[model samples]
Target: MALTDLYDRASSLLERRFLKNAFLPVAVFPVILSWPILIQSGRLDRLAAWWESLSTAGRIVLGLAYFVVTWFFAAIVASQWRNIIRLFEGYPIERTPLGQRSADWHRRRRTEATQWQHYLEYPDEDEVLPTRLGNILRTAERYPFARYNADTIVIWPRLYHLLPESVQRDVEDRRATLEFLLVTCLFWAAFGVADFIILSVTGAAPWVACLCLLVGAVGATLAYESSLSAAMEYGERIKAGFELHRGQLLAALGLKTPGSLEEEKRMWRAFDKFVRQARPADMEQYRRTSAPPTGGA
Candidate 1:
């Protein structure tokens, strides 16, 4: 089944309740960030002694860090909530309407053109299909509920939450895989930041902080690369499904099945790039390209 069908099968109750109450958490997020203030407000008599033990500057620093951390989290939640709303509202995963070009069409074409050329030059279908699919699947995971958007991390959870139970397992697995990579990236980045701050404050060796930063960057990069690899794995897993409905998939997109894997690769490269670039008015032109030319009457 196409992704559209899975979206249709999502739980209405979950969608309604989640969307209705999502704002509540975001609205109250400030309270969580204000724990230090709450302590000073005499709300926690038991911890008053402990709170008082901290120097004024220490308290201020801790409070500010808390505020920064929690606010950052709140922003992420709010962004994700917006994604959920868009999903429930029936946004297309790929925003470029069939045949209509997007603003970034040329840049997108330039990137995919390289991949298309690689596929054409290589005769390894088994390897190429996964590589191509992986890229596509990864991209899809990053931009759930929209064809184009900047909110590109941890999107699998939101998308998974929308799937019907029957389809949830597969999506959940994908989510888990992607989430692990994302969390790994965050973990390294956070540790590096924390280490840098601690080292700077203590006047400890600056080299240690620099080393921590480098390690964190490397970890994040590895995680990112792993995500792309995993995405390719995901694509391979779904390629059979795509093949099952190949005709429908191609027909809907104004594409034709290539006579050979090489041709298929070329067609897919064009199709992928074109879908991102084509304007609505160009839809007829695309259709005619794939259609048999009529004989002269």
Candidate 2:
């Protein structure tokens, strides 16, 4: 395929994936959150009667309006995708008191759990994040650096382009799943809070409001846990992409493929320096006019 066509295909795939991921939270969550208010206010019966009274054409117009509003919200949510991921990843919050305390607590828990040498390895204390989702993804992001001395943040865009279309599809699929789950978790939490507040303000029974809150909390917790598992799968796909296709990446860059593990690590470290600081890493010695062999070392 021509290069421009390939770029267009990738862009189109990404847009579709993003819209799919955005739809549930934008379209479903509002209805879920409004139920308690509707019930508490005794508005559902009135709304149903009103809806039944609408002319067919009026009902069609309302339906169209609902679709347009949901699509608009989805577009806004999709535009803020990076920020949403960061929020789930607990970024700037790490500097806050609550975040610091939570991180320290998690670090201690992991340390205790892994104190025995036979126990499974965990991320280092310094890499621990305030949220479980953040920790799962942080470990994934650090995988290249931890294993190959490659800075994944700097290398991923280049490496992704070099990946096979099948591998790229798998990675994108996993990412979309993770995004969907994270958004669900956030929306469920919002629903629970909104439901509780509406119930209380409308003079609903205290137990009823608490029940709604509990339902929302349970939904959010379940979604969050599912997202953690999704993240693990997504992380593995990413690690595999680097493990299996990194040589292709080097070859595409017109660089000689490293012959040994140590040599590859050294090359990655030097390339990272070059990419991050515009430092001359004497990379010319590694460049080759001929294409390097396919597949990873």
Candidate 3:
């Protein structure tokens, strides 16, 4: 299959499977991670006995829950690992249809709106300070495909891989932080499931089960929110590091970022329109037509 087709299919599959209900998948980890403990403590036998003793209705409910959890685990693990394998094997990270809606809406507004500069890098005198952190987060949230070290790596793999070790390390660290948070959240959720199973097997009151579920829900939310806040704080430094090497980054993508004020202004104007108007399928074409060539690092 073509690179774009592969990218779209991979991206759509990932977003559809994982992004929609990230927290729900956390339910799967309890069974997977607790297996060793269960076996070692002979709790696996006890758990089996408890399951076998349950009423037919209870068995059906528990079976359905486990099925959902296992399916989520299988789907998330397969989709993410496949994407990682594909990307490392030199595949492009193309934009998905969902990712393009924001740009398309912006493009529509640009047609009716007179203030085109608002969309560009240059901010008006009265505008809020467009801090580097704000810009990076906004872009990442609105246009994941446009972020640093994404599809550009596919276009200039040699140059991207040759970037300063420290710069590359910083980028990797940012990615690691996100991955750590995701795993942490998933594990926490799984632990909650374990708690529920233990409580139920030990003949806890129904009200106790309800309380545990509530606490688990709160814990998961807190974990997600806290990690997101921390990541955002660290993302600022990552953004700055990328900005410091903006020239090299653009060069790696075969784009010549403007050095002069006049050139910079012109480039921003063109980029604003390019990002706003280009369709997901037309992204490569836009870059080829608009981005001036740059000397490699």
Candidate 4:
């Protein structure tokens, strides 16, 4: 089975309300996980006290950091809630439409090309995005959905347009990954800070504050994870690139309205046959993604 299928199975299991409720406690395991690190470093108790004293603005900043940290996990749960989430293992293509998928490729490519036009075009703060993105885009254009706007394509030519392209070509798109993880780390940090703050502000026993904070932290962590899973729409886009409108692919592969079980079965086998041979990652034969999406056939 494909990664999408595996994700479907896992999600099906998570759907049982009892399972999700029981699993909620693990969300706050981050607190426990950080115990050794923070305790050995002696930052946990200090943070707890600071949270008690933080002004509303400081709290708000910490809150935002927490949100950022847990976004991906939240996005996944929300997908279950909205019925729009489809986990294709680690890829994003499974969830997006072909048109939008194509558009993203076009947009990324254009961003790539623009930086190459001149030295001034190079962004001072960040290196070009399109070039690194080109690896995935180049791999995706194989399925027919890779077609999109021309203006977008001219920007990121490929992994070999210029010295800059070749140099940045192998770089991984880890910005999203790092940002997601950073926010997750911040969330637990805020909990420890809150524990200290509550004890100081309310004159509560330190142990009592910890117990209350732990429960709240767990609930908050899971809820936040659910929300992030909903918002992190990247992996879906990756899966969409691979699947490429199964209906259209069905037609393209020469299967039509089925009249019998035998015919449908035959077509299914044929799809598997083509899939094994023409996987988009194959990259050698179908190197081109979208040739300006010609106006006519």
Candidate 5:
């Protein structure tokens, strides 16, 4: 397989997974800080009772301190959780078919697509192999047999759609991956919240609970990165599959592998139009069904 194909596969699979993995810590950091204070809650309650037995001025001072503490926690959780929820609920991109009509899934897809777009758009000279695979994919879309990567330049005489259905299925399977990730993220968020409650009720300080959650979020990122690196194996495999049979995809788009540059550029313009116009409905569907389940960490 060519380097361009390899990059495409890796780009699509890894970027969203990486971001979903990063979101947890942002949600849990405050909770971790509150633990130290929460640990003193019991003793503080006793102290407050004692103060209540003293003069009214003493009780008033204690009440004011409690208000400050509660307000601080509320402010922290409010601001942090909003960002966490937005990450989970992906805002703007959730409005398109490109996003699977689900925020989590949409953000995952949009991020991957945009990341790949960015990666391919740039060139790397310091690496073992310099790359412009993104442009190559576009070039190939317009001019099928055009081989830009040093590793591979072999192209067959074919259109994309003529390839077997199996290849099409492979490309579409990404949607399933999104679904899996969306559900998994929601589950983990809920688990984190539950763990927080369980530990907090046991007299763990709020900060301690927050720390535990932060650790959990970090663990999730590590696991996702590990899994994604493994999953990237698909990138290599699919590239091979596409090249072995490039006809199907090209035909589906009514594209010849090496179509004219002008035609390829124009087609992309059309694609943009379709994406912009139809995305609102897609976004609406996702908001209804794909918003993270109620009550996440």
Candidate 6:
């Protein structure tokens, strides 16, 4: 098959959310980041002249090539979305001295902040992460465990399947917004570094290079701060999802729903243990009297 046809087929297989959250940012970043550099280097005028000289067929071919290249980059970025999230979450950072120092600073700030009133978006001081976004998300991940003894990391995927369609959409939309902001933050930070290096190497006006760097830095900072709020909203949706659908999760697992909050907590603890350890004995008392209904029935 032709390359464009292959691109079409592959992109069609991805969901709309993936394209919005993963593809659009990657596709737009180059154009946004390159404009100032092109202008400063006097390449913009030459590029325009070159474009005007192209035949109709050449223009079409060039546009297609650009689209394909951007699409390929977007695909790569999309594939790494999970890893990017983990990076933003500051996982495995205690090994590095800088990371350890950052973690300690954030821990102290969180401790001071929570001394007066508990913030929903703040993780426990002991569990504090190096980044604000990380701590916000960690707080959400720990919510179910703290309140109901349910291990959210273990239960969330199954709980998501049990959520109503409307609830699922709400959760997915919030998560997509958070991811978009994070990706934008990374792009702008990269743009700042690349723009500074390229401008310095090309001997562009010192003021111009500094201005571009400042713009990029500001954009990155704004995106990162916005991502903190997005993370909190996404976390709230996760909390709501567990609150509203956890019983459905129990039912889906062929377990009986508990009648009281205390019973529910105990049931969740047992279920979590059974899931993690494959210990059927722990869940024996929680099993439903009747088997869960099958699709064909």
Q: What's the C-alpha lDDT at position 164 in model 1?
A: 41
lDDT tens digits by residue: candidate 1, 134-203: 3345334332212222122422333333334555455435544654454455555665666666556656
Which digits, one per residue and each the tens of the lDDT, describe model 3 over residues 56-98? 9998998799877767675666457434323321223224453
lDDT of each: 0.46, 0.82, 0.49, 0.40, 0.42, 0.82
| Model 3 root-mean-square deviation | 13.2
Task: State the lDDT of candidate 6 residue by residue for 1-297, as single tens digits.
Answer: 477965774465456767787778878888887887899888999999999999999999988998899888888888887777888888868558877898898877776775322456577778877777788898899999989999988999888867766786678778778878888888988888888888888998988878878988999899889988888889889998998777678888888868899988988889888878888898899889987665311
Worst 10 residues of 5 by lDDT: 125-134
Q: What ranking of all candidate models by TM-score puts the best one first?
A: 2, 6, 3, 1, 5, 4
RMSD of each: 13.9, 2.8, 13.2, 18.2, 18.7, 5.2
Instruction: Count the clashes in each prediction.
Output: 14, 0, 0, 35, 31, 0
Clashing residue pairs in candidate 2 (N, C-alpha, C atoms within 3 angstroms): none
Put down candidate 5 lDDT per residue, 186-279, tens digits, no spaces.
4445556766776788776678678667765765555444333333333433455545554343334343333555554444344334354653
What local lDDT does model 6 show for residue 242? 93
Candidate 4 lDDT, 20-123, residue by residue in tens: 32223235545655564465446888989989899999999987876565554654543442222112111254235753455455455546665333222222
Scored by TM-score, the top model is 2
> In model 4, what lDDT does residue 250 have?
33
Model 1: lDDT equals 0.46
Q: Which stretches of candidate 3 lie over 4 Å from their true place?
A: 1-28, 31-78, 81-136, 139-162, 190-203, 250-259, 268-297
Q: What would the per-residue lDDT of candidate 2 be over residues 1-297, giving only the tens digit for each residue?
A: 698988898898877776677865788887787877888788999999999999999999999999999988898888877788899888879899989998988787786674441122245678788987787788778888888999899899999988888898899889888888878888888888888887898799999899988998999899988988898889889888998888878877777868888988888887887887887656767777675554532
Lowest summed lDDT over 10 consecutive residues: which window, candidate 4?
81-90
Error of 1 at 200 (Å): 2.2
